[model samples]
Target: MLFTQAVRQFLEHLQAVDRSKETVKGYKAELGYFNHYLSVKHNGPVYLEDIQLEDMEAYMQHLKERKKSTATRNRVVYVLRSFYGYAVKRELCKKNHAELLEPVAIIQKERDFITEEELEILISHIHQPVIRTVIQTMFYTGGRITEMKNLKIKDVDLENEVIHIIEGKGKKNRDIPIGKTLHPILTNYFENIRDHENIETDYFFAIPKSGSISANYVNRLLKEAVDELGWNKHITAHVLRHSFGTNLLDKGASLVSIQKLLGHANLTVTSRYLHQDKDKLAEAVNLL
Candidate 1:
């Protein structure tokens, strides 16, 4: 089978298994670059069996030459591995060339987070009710943007004060408690802002006549608010999420509780938000 054809099959399988649209779109884009590279190198449609490990290695070099970040290059390579694994399973290819492609080491950086004061200021500047509610939800729930986008109106339980995160990352479902601050905001959005009756979609943040809003749409809304405040901080949805975890820690929420709330697979990932105030850390130590 042609490389492109195999990719099509793999993407179709992803959709058949109920993968999110964004996930399918991401795989298509990353695999498109590899297909383009193979087409240029071989000067025609490349077959799945004809792909060699060296060709994939060369593509890694190509990405490096273009100054792709370590994380991006690693993600592309990971996608290629997923693609070839599917191809091998389908018997379209005899060998999975991508299996040998090594991932680049990533240097972890300190995550950026918005302080409660900064977040308050940022929220004050967002004029759109939908955008404001979305931003608040991220901070309140510690949900990934994809999880937030996938949220349906039925997922929220106003009476019970919990938001059911269905099929989050790694196909995990968890519930986030609706806090006092966030509870009222969500109530206002549902009652006054969200036109669910006319929108014709179950998604909580659905665009009128459309489906769930794009991640880029949420990013652009955050960027506009940041720019208006003349803040130099690079705030994104993930930043708001980090802010949520960090703020919860500041307020004495335990790591285990946070792990469950954020739907983290492990406590180690949730522990990255351990940057407590210096004075507080010292006080804890002095208590001994």
Candidate 2:
């Protein structure tokens, strides 16, 4: 019934459920911070049953006073709710105190995307053959950086012109079509860089030196490319995905098709990438 016991159980449950390393670490860090706050405030350990609405309110206030962003505060509250839910379900607590707590309001900010012209310029400047191919694939497929990085040779069905996404976010698998424009580049990469290598693994992007490139390495390369191009816009691998979705929507692709291509479970999640122009929205309304 002690806080430490509950924390340990929560972590054990998370591991049992096969949670991602990042997710588990985040939950542990957030809950550990909450436990530390209770200990410091009360001069002793606080049990799950000892938690009150005031304690929750104080935690929210503490986060706010520390100038945590709305998004971060919301995430912390979410973690608390999940932990308390676990406790309640296991009969460790009579009720879920954290469940009733409200998250801070988060304003949905529009994401910045590169224009088609800017993308052309950026791609033109990237000299590395493999890096250029990877960047192009991201733009064309709207695949996450990890999805692309973790891609295997078998995942690409060149004859079918489709790329298989295995174990994407939320453990979902889907296939997206590869554009004809990228086929030649992909074929060349495979024939030149991949064919000669004695790779025992199936990963498509494995380098001769490192085997596989880390997400940090991809981001660093993207940063260097962005700097070399002297573009003021914030660019990352995710931006390439956003650009693909936006481009599709601009070309009048339906939300349903885009959702499937992006492997978004919910249409609402894919709606974020629709990014309709104000002028287009107005024009459609006028026709209506």
Candidate 3:
């Protein structure tokens, strides 16, 4: 069988299975790029079983030369592995060369967060009620952008001062307690603007009275605040969540506590939020 024919069958399998629409689209695009590379590297009539191991290795190097990130490379490699595995099962290929490919190491980027000083400046300068409240909620609750957008008016417990993330990442529901400093901001946004506007939608940060606030819009708002403060950092809603975790760490909160509050699946993911502080390191050495 031709290599393209095998790839087409694999894609059809993805669409016929449990893969989401977005996942299917992304895999299609990735495989399409791979097919293009194969076409350029060799003349026509490329057979599924004819691809040598050297060709597989060369394609891996080609990805690196294009400066693809570790995650992108890993995803591409995974797709190919699945494809070639299918080909092997169907007797179209002798073996799956993509299976033996080693994954690239993913280096976590430097944690970008808002300093306390920058936080104060950002809050003071944000005059719009909804926009300001959105930032405040993110900073205080450490809710994912999607979680925040999905928040309903009923999710905020004004009496208890808590926000409920009904279905965050992993489809896990969690609660984040409100800090005293952020209480008034959320209270007023809930009781005043959201109520006063009589927003036709029930979402906490719903815009246009039709749908929830989008992640892109939230980031754009954050960018405007960063630009106004002349801060060089490219801060976003996710950065605010990082700031929440880092700030909690500074306040002597445990990694386990942060993991639960941030709805992170494990301690390792939560640990990345704990940035190294010179003063904290000094204090630690002194204790030793």
Candidate 4:
């Protein structure tokens, strides 16, 4: 079967299995990019069976030539692995060269997350109720902006103090605890803003007539707050999430609790946020 056609089948399977919309869209775009590169490299469409290790190596080199970041190149290669795995399952390909491709190490920099005090400052500065609540939710819940965008009114449990994250990253469902600060912020938003808007849609957050609140808009809102506070950092919704884990770690919360709170599949991923604090480094040096 044609390689591009196989990609379509794989993406459809992702949708059928109820993968997150961003995952489906991102994987589709990445695969499409690879398909274009492979077609150009081979001077035409290459069949699934025609794929070889050399082709995979050349594609990696092509990504480097294009000045793609290590993380971006890794994602493209990972998508290729998923694609070929699907092809192999359907008997369209004999082997998965994408998996056999050498690993590319990503040098992930530590993201600057807001301090608890800064979060309070940010919330205090955001006069807009919807936007304030959105920041509060990210700080309190550690949810991705996409997860917040996908949230429905029904997902919030006010009485129980839980936010049900239905199908977060890795297709995992988790319930994050509602913080004392966020509970009041959310209550006010619902009572004053969200209810007054009378939006017919089930989505918890949206602009009037614009449908759901977009990730781009949320980023802009954060950028404004960061600028107003004179914070010399690029903080996004995910950075707020990083803050959530780091804050908890600072407060003597166990890594196991944080792993569960962030819905990380393993402890290693959760451990990344623990060592960035200067206090933690100082304490470690004194142990000698």
Point out where model 4 deviates above 4 Å: 124-128, 195-198
Candidate scoring better on lDDT of 1 and 2: 1
Estimate, for each residue in 204-234, the C-alpha lDDT of model 2 and write its tens digit.
8776666665677666778888899777777
Give residue 97's lDDT in candidate 4 (0 to 100): 81
Q: Candidate 1, residues 1-288: lDDT per residue as tens digits? A: 788898999999999998877789999999998899999999999988888999999999999999999999999988999998888898888898898999999987767688878888998988867878899999888989988888998999999999999988877899999999999999999999988777888888876646567778788988998999888888999899888988889898889998898888889888865456678889999999
- Report every candidate's CA lDDT: 0.88, 0.84, 0.81, 0.84
Minimum summed lDDT over a 10-residue window in model 1 is located at 206-215
lDDT of 3 by residue, 124-181 (tens): 8776667778888888878888788889888888789888888676567899998898
Model 2 clashing residue pairs (backbone):
none
For model 3, the run of ten residues with the poorest summed lDDT: 190-199
Distance from true position, residue 92, model 2, in Å? Answer: 2.2
- Candidates ranked by TM-score: 4, 1, 2, 3
- Give the alpha carbon lDDT tens digit for every residue of 1-288 in model 4: 788888888989999988878899999999888788889988999787887889888988988998989988888878888888888888878888888887689777877887878888887766666767888899888888888998998999888989999988988899998888889878877777885455778888866666578888878888887889888998888888899898888888999999999999899989975547776889979999
Error of 2 at 284 (Å): 1.9
Best by TM-score: 4
Q: When superposed on Cα atoms, how far off is each prediction in RMSD?
A: 2.5, 2.7, 4.0, 2.1
Model 3 earns a TM-score of 0.76
Which residues of candidate 1, in runs, are more than 4 Å off? Answer: 16-18, 196-198, 207-212, 273-288
What TM-score goes with each of the models? 0.89, 0.86, 0.76, 0.91
Tell me which residue pairs clash in candidate 1: none
Q: Candidate 3's error at 25, in angstroms? A: 6.9
